[model samples]
Target: MHEKQKARDVMTPDPVVLPEDTPVVRAAKLMRDQAIGDVLVTRGDRLRGVVTDRDIVVRAVAETRDISVTPIGALCSTHVVTVDPDQDADDVVRLMREKAIRRVPVVEKGHPIGIVSLGDLAVEWDPTSALSDICAAPPNE
Candidate 1:
């Protein structure tokens, strides 16, 4: 039997990242340009938090923070669960399921190198499923 794939095998590498002090607006723009839902927030090379599109809507916009000047660190989710590159993808699925989260950063030596989402797991575990098909679809303009 083939060995199970590791997190590195299915992760999307070189994920968009920004410093904690970066303005929330910049992170929003990066998400729009990259067609990604979240950006990893860092303090130096260490992963500090994560900011998702919804975070902007709920935390910044709804709260009326000045997006242009508000640092992403102020609104980003600081408590994040991460996986190491060598971890089994199957374990990642379990972690996601247990945490009820859709995404997890893949870290190495305290720095993020990639991100893995529920969609990534769908593609790897069941390519023919509807979720996998949706994950594989190109982003709508």
Candidate 2:
């Protein structure tokens, strides 16, 4: 039953989105304010890329690029993988694993409508899974 779950069933609807041309610093600040790790970059209603807080650190800061001058597109992924709302969860998980990706955008008609993360798959696959437990576990001092 769990394996048959669809991407839309566990996806976070209306995820944070930004224009690809947004400055990296602005995007990072939005992420910080939202307390989210990633944002979907778009051009109008079309999905363009995905940018993570880690991307900013590893791709921009580490390279000594000026965050204020750098656009999110410069560091965000171009060939982002996506899943259909009706796609099988297993397939989504397989894609994520094969691509070493932690999340996948849920798109329809070239527009992103939602997003599914590994944690979402974990919880859907097994309610008492270790991944779920880890997500619930309190932070260590």
Candidate 3:
């Protein structure tokens, strides 16, 4: 039997990433520039965490923290839910569902090689599901 499609097969290779010590403002800028909601935080090629736009808004701005001096690592979700590149895609979907998260980093030996979002999965692997339709829908903007 053929091996099931793994995270690597469906992941978005070369996902947006930044150093863990990146200033919050810079990190948020990168996310805006990339049109992405989240950016993977790294420490010299090693996966560190994920900083979402929401994190900046709630963890920093909402809290009236100094964005210009605060580093993303302090505000990012350090307990990031990650998937191995070789893991089955089904597992990734299940994890996302349980966590209610829309995206996960695909890692290999502690290094992030890609990301697999619900939208990516829906578009490429689950075209008939309602999620696919929702994910494939164009943004209001």
Candidate 4:
């Protein structure tokens, strides 16, 4: 039943989005404030890329970049894998597996509307699973 659901049905809507030129430090702060792992990078209303907390750590901190001045676009993963809102959730899962990605932006006309994560899938498809339990749990913070 859930497997047949569409991306729009399962995705977390109104995902946080930021401009490409925004500073990495600011993005990091926003992520912390929102308790979110990633932010969709946009350029003039068009989906550009996705930047995650991991990207900040590995690409900025580890690389000794100036987070206060470095633009998130510089570290964001631009070769993003996206799915349409009308796409099947099952197909999204398959694409995630094939791409080795944990999250995918749900786009419409090149604008991100939502995001679907592995955790979301677990909760939808196997609510009793350990992963689902963890995902459904309240945020540790």
Candidate 5:
């Protein structure tokens, strides 16, 4: 059997984050700049919540709430579910599936150190070899 891959193997290291007090617009900006769908909300490295593009669209824009004036804390998903670095990727996938979550924060000693998304796991596992093919291919002509 293949050795189990740990969360550390697939998680993005030192993930870009925002403070709990950051406004929703700023968090959206950070996500856009990073080309990521979500960002971990932290307080000095301690995980607090998660903000996603969907959150902005649903809770702010769709609701006609002012993104620039609303704090991320108002829209972020608190009580974040996290995974340990040593946990197997399969287990992480299971947890995410059960929770209907697309991202999992990787934490150590009560502090977040990284993040993993569904896309991350897809690339790591390459179930259909799609990710492998993409990685093996050179830039598009």
Candidate 6:
């Protein structure tokens, strides 16, 4: 069903990212400022890892660690799974489901190009028409 849809159609292009050396607090601040859940960690143009708000809460704060001394690289999920910009959305969705991940980085020519989230797919698969129906109806109904 998603054969005709490209990653570009759903991916957030030119996403803001952080360097591996960025302090955890700074990364968190950037995520908050951008209103994004995840931040790609890069070394030059190469994708190194990814850090999410959950990572900070679960791996840092919950662990009682100091954010100032912690590098984002320390909490980042390295060797992240990625998708190609030209790949079909259905294939990407299947891959995400199998990996149990809500986000996937879009890469091209060995460089990070964009990112896609579960929300992106939800909207791509069905825009406000379907989403409104799901939201407007009572959960038990």
Q: Write down the TM-score of every candidate.
A: 0.95, 0.88, 0.87, 0.95, 0.85, 0.85
| Residue lDDT tens for model 4, 1-141 | 553789999899999999999999999999999888999999999999999999999999999999999999999999999999999898999999999999999999999999999998998889999999998887667
> What lDDT score is found at residue 111 in candidate 6?
82
lDDT of 1 by residue, 1-141 (tens): 226999999899999989999999999998888889999999998999999999999999999999999999999999999999999988998999999999999999999999999888788778999999998998989
**Every candidate's lDDT:** 0.94, 0.88, 0.90, 0.94, 0.84, 0.84
Q: What does the lDDT read for residue 42 in candidate 2?
A: 92
lDDT of 6 by residue, 1-141 (tens): 444788878898987777888899998888777677899998877899889999999999999889998988889999699999999887888999999998999988868889988877776666666753553354441
Candidate 2 lDDT trough over 10 residues, lowest sum: 132-141
Please report how far candidate 4 places residue 89 from its true position, in Å. 0.7
Off by over 4 Å in 4: 1-3
lDDT of 5 by residue, 101-139 (tens): 888999999788898888777666775677656544554
Identify the superior model by TM-score, candidate 1 or candidate 5: 1
lDDT of 6: 0.84
Off by over 4 Å in 5: 127-141
Error of 5 at 36 (Å): 0.8
Error of 2 at 30 (Å): 1.7
Give per-candidate clash totals. Answer: 0, 0, 0, 0, 0, 0
Question: Which parts of model 6 have CA positions greater than 4 angstroms off?
Answer: 1-3, 129-141
For model 3, how does the per-residue alpha-carbon lDDT over 32-101 read when each residue is reduced to its tens digit? Answer: 7767889999989999999899999999999999999999999989888999999999899899999999
Evaluated against the true structure, the overall lDDT of model 3 is 0.90
Best by lDDT: 4
